[model samples]
Target: MLIDKPLPELRRYRGRNPRPADFTRYWREALRELDATPVQPELVPNREIDVPGVECFDLWFTGVGGARVYAKYLRPKAPIGRRHPAVLQFHGYSGNSGDWLGKVPYVAAGFCVAALDCRGQGGRSTDAGAVQGNTLNGHIIRGLDDPDDRKLLFRSLYLDTVQLARVVMSRPEVNPDRLGAMGASQGGGLTLACAALEPRIRRAAPVYPFLCDYQRVWEMDLAKDAYAELRDYFRRFDPCHEREADVFRKLGYIDCQHLAPMIKGEILMYTGLMDQICPPSTQFAAYNHIRARKEMVLYPDFGHEWLPGEADRTLRFMLPLAR
Candidate 1:
């Protein structure tokens, strides 16, 4: 949660001159960036896990090279009237998949929800409470062999999120048109990127997302991974400085700044002024770049903790946002 951000007033761009173009460009870029391997997840239902009238299950999402990723999907047990709108949820970087177990708000509000487990992360239902106890190595930068591979490395986790949502939409009980994405911290960043990259998502809410403004993330040295990964990459390989810059530029091209605007759905971005992990300026940068109709909630004192009564506010906001 430690961030070395600069003075906020300095970077705050009150003058909005440039506008992000459209989602089409980002969508195509994501497709190009993704591998065309036969990626699929084997979803096995879990009748044991109890979710209020919603059948929840564990899913095994296979990544590009047959990497096994985990996910959890929840659907209304019995179809009520027509199919219900669905929400695919992701988790924070310092956290894992099951963190989204509290997503009953949307279900109780009459919707299906899919909460996915990020790979190399523990807090999966099968491995609950394991990583939290371990004073650990930074897993976010696990595959930082090269800067170009960082985003590619995150692909498995992010694609699992996107594909799991697509899987949920493939269900007869889910209203694909109403599908949306939501997450907090790193999850929030993923929510934004997934909403932008995955065109199917009609609504999005990114809360204190990580991995934005790569340059700033390195500057702040927030959590390890990113900086740690880059440092290690440069250290071990001693790659050309120019090569590293080019790699970061490509990474920036795939940055949330370029993608947030592409999300045509109603977006709700939330951040805290005191947030060390995600500086307010960077949050605002992404928010300002969001070309779609959106809303933002600023919490002055709250740090990494969940904002009190935020679910109600989100419900109220999303209920009316039936775009």
Candidate 2:
């Protein structure tokens, strides 16, 4: 496991980041804002992919702060009248909803699929850029300098997942009760967040989620690669570590570990013990806090990269939703 903690320790980890006292109230107000913002969803037919059994479309919806979020939507072609099970797929950080062909397996299994393209990433979504801080390095610290913690970019990003879920659920052809979500890395974190914010999510599979235990990452000095923004933020904004506690306290608003307890769905989390990018302990921090029906798949020899048979296992885990 290299420098990663032992399995026993990882399982018991509760995370090191501070949890804001008003964490629940903060999200309540955020949800209130999302409720007021109209999600104007539009679907444009995609003619490029020549798949036989599925229909594809470019789905667009207005997210929080009036940003237009995009998702690649696909559904079975033959089953038109009845509603079908649905799955929401989120991508890794700085990435977009992948090609339409990749989502065909769910459609083939008679499931409606929507893969979100996070705002301001490598996709069609638009970033409002309305925050008041340094936006140079990454999304993590985009709004750290703002007095209002609501300005945090991840707050809006997390709310976008909820908005997307609502839009998918509103579709006449989607069975809301059978809805599931799955993702890796940043997407994994968003999966946890989505399931947390929207209790309607029936199943969730998050593979080595990021955005948990920020202070732990910094403390361990593993903030170089995916968490480089943490190092950058401290160096550029608070070099003297003066506002260290306050900074992490504000970040507590977006940490996935704090949000895990809010999930009401069944969860299947995957963690690679040798992962330095998002260390195993950090992933377990959120996983351990989940109060819902949950299970974990640990890869003893694996790291942040791909784990063998993960795709097949994920497909099988989510297959029950199709019933």
Candidate 1 displacement at residue 138 in angstroms: 5.4
Tens digit per residue, CA lDDT, model 1, 3-106? 32344552453222122244345456546544464556576887655666767677665554445557766666674556888887788764666633576667
Tens digit of lDDT per residue, candidate 2, span 185-250? 999999999999999999999999999999999999998888998998999889999999999999
Would you list the C-alpha lDDT of every candidate in the order shown? 0.63, 0.91
Identify the runs in model 2 with alpha carbons over 4 angstroms from their true place.
130-136
Model 2 global lDDT (CA atoms, 0 to 1): 0.91
State the lDDT at 262 in candidate 2. Answer: 97
lDDT value, residue 30 of candidate 1: 49
Which candidate has the top score in lDDT?
2
